[model samples]
Target: MPDIDDFLRNQERIITTRGWAVTHVLPTDDDPDTTAPFAYTVGLTAHDHPELIIAGLPPLVAHTLLNDLARQVYDKAERFSHGQRISDLIAGYDAVIIDGRPTDDLLPGAAIARYGRLRIRLQQIVWPDQQGRFPWDSGYNFDPHIQPMIAHL
Candidate 1:
């Protein structure tokens, strides 16, 4: 896993260069700390920007922030029209890219379940095969195994 500090630094760099607002939640040391987990929800706007909504942000004490915003796409196919999409809530927001990599198991299941109702497919930020730039795939998506746990979230 990539060091959390490095991740946060990368995110800070992106915010500095791109000039976007970032929000992060930091967790306590204990596993499943009553304190919440460390994560960030970032958004961008020209000038008068709106607030972005994301769930399960702990305190902003110490946490990792990714410099490159990893794209987390919510596939429309997964959701019904007029349904909630992660993109809609955080529109124009860029995600901090995950360098070390995050696993589905580590993510908050409840929070993810909320999105699933919309049939959302949370995928990592990556260029489509047709784009053919680095030819490397980006983004890690949630798999079905996580579904059962979301109800509790």
Candidate 2:
């Protein structure tokens, strides 16, 4: 199995190579608001604005992390293709109170449900870009030795 650090580094490489910027945050145990050991906020800018924020739980495996990242990127690309604004995508609903109590429990649960579905779909499908190339592929087979190994194997 790959080390978590190595896996995250590879993710960063892939995202950057695809023309998006990634911001990684590693919080210490001393922090009171720490949700996970590692968290990433990815976007196209160097600032705090992020298109996706992923938190890695203690039991979260590498594949899950990768799938979540990939799903978010795919969703972002799809929305962009449809001319959706980033601000519209990231906009949050104002919390409403009924009988002087918050009724926002369903909001978080809905987001989680959406994410769960996305991750499952990501695992089952190889999402292709506008050019019909898989996101993980560089659109070229530059390595001369890989084909020979594939034929032999």
Q: Name the runs in model 1 displaced over 4 angstroms.
A: 1-13, 21-23, 30-32, 41-46, 56-83, 86-153
Q: Write the per-residue lDDT of candidate 1 for residues 5-90, one digit (tens) a residue.
A: 77657755765665433444444365453433334333332222211222233234112222223222111112121122233322
For model 2, the run of ten residues with the poorest summed lDDT:
94-103
Clashes of each: 17, 0
Q: In terms of TM-score, how similar is model 1 to the real structure?
A: 0.26
How high a TM-score does candidate 2 get? 0.26
Runs of candidate 2 with Cα error greater than 4 angstroms are 1-15, 21-23, 29-38, 45-50, 59-76, 80-153
On the 0 to 100 scale, the lDDT of residue 109 in model 1 is: 32
Residue 53 C-alpha lDDT in model 2: 29
Question: Total clashes, candidate 2?
Answer: 0
Shift of residue 113 alpha carbon in model 1, Å: 31
Q: Report how far off residue 29 is in candidate 2 (Å).
A: 5.0
Question: Can you write out model 2's per-residue Cα lDDT over 1-153, one digit (the tens) per residue?
Answer: 888678557756765665333333444568644333332233322221123322233324323543454455554643212112232221241111011110121111222232332221111111223344322347723332111110110
